[model samples]
Target: MSKQLVVYISATGTTRRVAQNLAKAIDADLAEIVPAPPFTAQDIDWTDPTSRASRQHADRAMRPPISASPSVDGYDEIFVGYPLWWDTAPREVRTWLESHDFTGKTITTFATSSSSTRGALGEQLHDSAPDAHWVNGRRFAANASEAELKAWADSIA
Candidate 1:
């Protein structure tokens, strides 16, 4: 079994595509952190302050319930993927992180975003799993290539 795992949450499917490619490239196991009551198209609307995403992003304490835990046992390294939502990962990531044991593991974060910056991810992720070794993360364009993903995974390995 591969020691590495590629786990991610994608509300709009873009991050899911990237996660699939990254897992294939690195020959790692893959898992998705799904949100319970699942997100409707309207729930992701950033423009509406009343939207589910907007409400969650506006508040720090909202840890959205995930469907289940993607057990992290036996993995030495994990690459966490997500879309850069409101300058950080969606709150469901917090739900996923809290469910796992990351001690002695290395976590490298990567995200897909329309913005030029990777946004405020490192601190949030580190804060979620303080015992895990966190590394510098990268932001990828929506059109990021498979080769580029492979290269990044190889470098981390």
Candidate 2:
């Protein structure tokens, strides 16, 4: 079996937990895609749609900086985790995806969201990395079971 890597960008900690669960199941390396400066509570103002962060997201140009870049070489399978924002991925995820090369590798995505469907996020990932063999995306509640996530990861492998 080829080595696997789980890369995640989390906002509310839900995605981070999911990523860790999946990584443990597959014995994969876990890499957190932390934004350079990090987002403050004020920057996430989900309550105020007129906030700067919200406005930048509305314009589809909210590219938050990343603190570290993950190495994709030697990993045949990559599992990416994130929270669904604005019916898609967070801007930092875009930065991470664009920063790496996944040629000839299998890419899987999982997301956690309160309202949005996983299909939308999966489609967005497919669009972003057209050459990648994107698999079905999964959605779980904030308090999902570790066994459930492990089973899902095993099925994909």
Candidate 3:
């Protein structure tokens, strides 16, 4: 069996729950992309343009520091999950991606969004880990079932 890893960041547990289901569905190891100092409820308030998340989204070059980066070594496939932020992965995700060398690994991105589509999420992340083989990403509803996740994983893997 191929070693798989599910890495994600969830500001309010929505993405976390999805990542858990995905990891379980595929029998993959799980890891969280926790931001340094963590995120407070107020930090992610999208309505507030000055909120941390908002500021970071506006700054294309901003890469928030992560608390820790999980080792990508030995993993044959890595699934990166995050809540869609401005139709793209969070800057924190970028930090984590940039921290690793996914030279020949297979990377699949998944996201959760109440409204927005996945957009060009997988392509947008290419520069951060330029050498990895990227698969097209999918956006799942928060209540997506284990079977649904497993089917998607099977199709990709």
Give the Cα-based TM-score of candidate 2 against the true structure: 0.87
**Tens-digit lDDT track of model 2 for 1-157:** 8889999877768888888887887789999988777756666676788753576468675566789768788988888888776667777777787777777888888888887774433667665557677887778777777788788888877
Instruction: Compare candidates 1 and 3 on lDDT and give the better one.
Output: 3
Best by lDDT: 3
Model 2 has an lDDT value of 0.77
User: 28-75, model 3: which lDDT tens digit per residue?
Assistant: 999999999798898878899998879988898998899879899999
Candidate 1 stretches with Cα past 4 Å from truth are none
Model 2: which ten-residue window has the lowest total lDDT?
118-127
Highest TM-score: give the candidate number. Answer: 3
Task: Give the CA lDDT, 0 to 100, for residue 122 in model 2.
Answer: 69
* RMSD, every candidate, angstroms: 1.7, 2.0, 1.1
Q: After superposing candidate 3 on the true structure, give the runs of residues whose Cα lies further than 4 Å from its correct spot.
A: none
Positional deviation of 96 in candidate 2, in angstroms? 0.9
lDDT per residue (tens digit) for residues 1-157 in model 1: 3499988888788888888888888888999988897778898788999987799888988888988669889999898988877778888988888778899988888888777364534567778888898887788776677789999877766
TM-score (C-alpha) between model 3 and the true structure? 0.96
Cα error, residue 141 of model 1, in Å, equals: 2.2
User: lDDT of each model, Cα atoms only?
Assistant: 0.82, 0.77, 0.89
TM-score of each: 0.92, 0.87, 0.96
Is candidate 1 or 3 superior in TM-score? Answer: 3
Of models 1 and 2, which has the larger lDDT? 1
